[model samples]
Target: MKQANSGALVVFGLVLIAGLGGALLARGALYLGMHEGDTLHLLDMALRMGLHGQWPHLDFMTPIGILAIAPIAGLVAMGLGIGTAILWAQVLVALVLLLPLVRMAGSRFGGLWSYVMLGYGVVLCLALVHGLANPAPSVSMHYNRWAWAIVYVVLPLALLPDRGRARPYLDGALIGLGVGALVLIKVTYAAALGPGILVALLVRREWRVLVVAVVAGCAVLAVMTALGGSGFWVAYLTDLLTVAQSETRPAPGGIDFADAVAGPANMPSSILALAVVVLLRMTGRKAEGLALLVLAPGLFYVTWQNFGNDPQWLLLLGAAVFALLRTDQPDSRHAGRLHDAMKIAGVAALALTASSAVNIAYSPIRHLFAEAGNTVPLLSALAGQDDIRVAEKRLYKVDAGVPLDGVGQPFAAYHDRADRKELSRLKGEVLPACELSTGYNAMFETIAADLEAQGHAGSAVLTADLLGSLWMFGDLKPLKGGAPWYYGGAPGLAAADLVVVPLCPTTEKSRATILAALEKSGWRFDELRRTDVYILLRPVRP
Candidate 1:
């Protein structure tokens, strides 16, 4: 009891430090890197839910589980500005996971490992940058980070023997809650880790834990269903399937699954994981070894499927190595040699993944020091959100590229070899093969202002591009049934009053895909207005 209590105290101290740092970040403006588009997507969804009393899958189309944005939305609902809400949401997640972290870490981990378990928990919850080592501090895919923290908490509880007396109910509840949280945050993580977790409990004969996890998961589902109504499940699944079947983003960021698993950058981590599995098996811990083996493929899939495909799994793998090292299996043979090998593997795993872990840990500090003079407010019309800023160059510089394929152009000579194809024809109007590379912040604000000027201030817009975020900038309503970020299908089309087609879209493929879907659906539009920037059309509703 003393040990657990002392360890819990250490966790609180670490969490308090992170909490103070998060408050500082909330006070200062945030400067994001390489993910303004994703940031905007999150901000838009959060605002839709917060300001409009809306819900995902009911009011909008998205595969992302509500828990991803609900905490931030909850903060926004409580009258905090968007910028502060985002920062504080991280702190809130860390605080929410405190009980599980303390319980799991204190009961299972010893000395340095106990501190490590709790410390990483705080990092995962309060991290300003989504961890991959290329840290410039941005709040994007933060749910993934939160899910990982829950994974860390649950993993040790399921895998290791408790240092103290067994408390299956407490352990079971934590496991169940963690898994349920994962399901509600992002089902992909839950799907990936589910089998391994179940297998671990089954192999270890932790039937109580297994039953409790399932019941708790179902309870979470029941609670959400009651809140969002029974239709929520069907709509949520539909949105997920739509994204899964999307032709535009078959694998996020065009990642090669094989490469992500065994490529030069990730090969070492893969090898280290396999070695640990073999070492564990040889030392009379086949169940632990087997669970890790099952976890390996899921880990790889998640790394590849996520945008940027950062190998954040390495930290988890490192934790696994240390946890196994701390355990004693009396029936083991060749224990000395294999245990030494395990120590080497643990060190190697942590060393390889150290940069990413360090980067995530330091992000709040990095965000606190971002220069304000060189940046402008992220949203132009959001009155009190000046605390979220973007670099002037990223926000205001308009740049687009169209392939050179004219009668007299140099590329015309090699047209056959160029693999050139005209994009999509929208209502018999051919869109050029053009892409808007920068100035998205400007694009949304400009279109919103223009639409408001033309007496379309409060209309719901469905952009024929990758994003439909004009509502964030001016007097427009977020489409009642829109996808914050397009993932195939005409999600918000029927609910939209107008369609804004940018001349140079952020993603040409998305533009072409959306237009093709519209054409197949036989949707017709009346040209309301046209300008150098966009074509505004009113959909002829059935």
Candidate 2:
């Protein structure tokens, strides 16, 4: 008993070191490799929530739950530099989750498996980059990483029986807090795995676990409600429905639901899961088999819902498959085959997910080297802080897009042959058939400076761009009730004094979508001015 306890402590100690050391390796700075737009979106929301004391859903609009940005916002509110706040917030989150991780990992796993499970949680918490093995580092969809970490901590406790003693209270409470955190971080995760967790506990007759998890989850909800109010939930649901119903909000990189499940990239893990489910049932591990049967679709759903469609669940699935092997009966002749098959499946699953796992674990090490490139500060608003920097080319290089043939060309008959979506129109005004790419920080800072120079400083501006982050760049006041990223609707129109319409947007369809929604909502506006940069309009009382 002493040896095992000490082993768990050693594994946890390694996890703590890996987490804190990795974060501190950045030297209190955050260097981003890609996804400046997404980073700007996060910073905009954090400043709004922190400096302006805005509440998500109440004072602004976003599908992302407040908890996703609140910790960083709180730190920024305390006058911490944004990049420093991000790194330390990660450290804070790791420390906060350490106990839950200890309870879950210590109770359920033994040997190296404990390290794999808990270390992965630390990686999810502390990694500077969001997962996609080969891609450059980014903080984009970081909440998804956090949500997956919570899922890791929860599902293990829910599915696996304890190694030493079954303390249902500790397990259930942790599971509850995890799921609750998932809901508050990214609702898609909870919506994905919450049912499977409940059923797994039910099938195992772990009534205490189930009841306590429900109570704990509700306790989290109650606390959030007491802090924000019931309307917060309604607004959260509204934001979710907006995304669910919007055609533009599908999984990015053109990955649809079927693609997430059966696409070339996902096929291996999907096959491994199916084979393992069959093997688990064949080996008389019916409860776990049923759980996986239910879990596979949920995993696919979350992958499809997330921006990158990363199959991060594969590692956990692989871990669970290996763990299930220990539960098999020794008498069956097929036990040998089941063990062999589980081993192969588990190993293959891990192999498939290995690149991304390694990528996540190696992010901070990569961050240290990211400074080798010619870099510039991420935002001029936080300029001179020098804590957040990006590659020079990613900011200065702009891609405004190439148009198809004009009136007298070969493809002229095709008429604006772009991608899948058509060029958008707003209130009978056709937007240009072009899109902006890269140069997010440069673009926002330039436009914000121009607006300030034109005597619009401190004015609340609503931008008909993919992100409403003009406030992040200059003296403009943060939109009191606007979305940082447009997920549809005229989100902050009520608080917007001027609407700035970009001719060439980073995401043309999204820009068109927002403009159309604002027009459709009957927002009365008078065209104030037009420039090479943008068309400005002032909202008028109808």
Query: Which candidate number maximizes lDDT?
Result: 1
Q: Clashing residue pairs, candidate 1?
A: none
lDDT per residue for candidate 2 within 34-76, as digits (tens), equals: 8888888888878788777888878877888888999999998
- Scanning candidate 1 in windows of ten residues, the lowest lDDT window is 1-10
Q: How does each model score on TM-score?
A: 0.95, 0.94
- Tens digit of per-residue lDDT, candidate 1, span 1-542: 12356545565646565665564465455677668888889988999989888998888988888999999999989988888888878877877777778887788776667777777877888877777778676888888888888988888888777778788888888888888888788888888878888888888899888888888888888898888888998888888899899987788847688988888877888888888888888777889888888878887788787877777777666766766673465545655667788888888988988888998887777677766667788888877766677789988898888778656787787767777666677877787678988899788888998999999988999998888777888889889888789989777889889988888999988888888887787778889999988999888864
Candidate 1 local lDDT, residue 78:
95
TM-score, predicted candidate 1 vs. hidden true structure: 0.95
Q: Each candidate: what lDDT?
A: 0.81, 0.79
How many clashing residue pairs, candidate 2? 0
Which segments of candidate 2 are over 4 A away from where they belong?
Answer: 1-3, 6-11, 18-26, 327-331, 383-386, 408-410, 416-422
Which whole-number lDDT from 0 to 100 does residue 316 have in model 1? 65
Model 2 accuracy (lDDT, Cα)? 0.79
For TM-score, the strongest prediction is: 1
